[model samples]
Target: MTESDAATASLRPTDAIVLTGLRVRAHHGVFDFERENGQDFVVDVTAHLDLSPSAVSDDLSRTVHYGELAVEVADAVRRDPVDLIETVAERVAAVVLAHEPVHSVEVTVHKPDAPIEVPFDDVAVRILRGRS
Candidate 1:
């Protein structure tokens, strides 16, 4: 799909599997000190898919396995460090979309301990991705 199409695509109006507040330690930042010290990155993911088959048949295969997804997301975050949380969020979205059952995925990567001189609650990057 074109970039515009992907950007405009709406998430499927179906049951969603949501995982939140997943914390991982990684060295990702634009500054040397920030990357060297490392920091906790919080992730939130939402996968949209049909749950009727899984709900009716009680089959784990019919739906996304969140347990496995979380582990995979953690591993993705721990991969080679990048300078931006946008990249991190994209990595997570890629991992979630890799699951066949997931029609669309929403990923939010939160950098709570960001090296901002100003006092702020938090800094995060959120993205939505879907199959073409």
Candidate 2:
């Protein structure tokens, strides 16, 4: 494997907390009409961290609370609208990483109802972030 690949693999956490198909209505788009009307945006997030502490102690404090995380992510998306899903993805990642236990995060912002001329299933932006 390449040096970079090895480094990435080594840094990856073994356990994860995944939340998917979170739909939120937000005004985020370049077009004025889209911002005025608003649309549903789907977000998926995976937070990687060591789950062993919570597993062994059965203490909620030992791990990130996914329910709270979901709310934060939704709230982040609903905040001031930006034209790009990339920005939304970054916001979500920041929220996830804010939880001290999270070692890394994967965020996907899906714009299924994006204003597109041609028929398409969906448009999404996915990003990965970790502590440096």
Best by TM-score: 2
Cα lDDT for residue 20, candidate 1: 97
Error of 1 at 73 (Å): 0.4
Root-mean-square deviation of candidate 1: 2.4
lDDT of 1: 0.90
In terms of lDDT, the poorest run of 10 residues in model 1 is: 5-14
**Local distance difference test, each candidate:** 0.90, 0.92
> How far does residue 95 in candidate 1 sit from its true spot (Å)?
0.4
Clash pairs of candidate 2?
none
List the candidates' TM-scores in order.
0.91, 0.92
**Model 1 residue 26 CA deviation in Å:** 0.4
Candidate 2 wrong stretches, greater than 4 Å: 1-11
Q: After aligning candidate 1 to the native by TM-score, how far in Å is the CA of 60 from where it should be?
A: 0.6
In candidate 1, what are the lDDT values of residues 9-94, reduced to their tens digit? 65654689999999999999999987898999999998988889999999998888889999999999998999999999999998
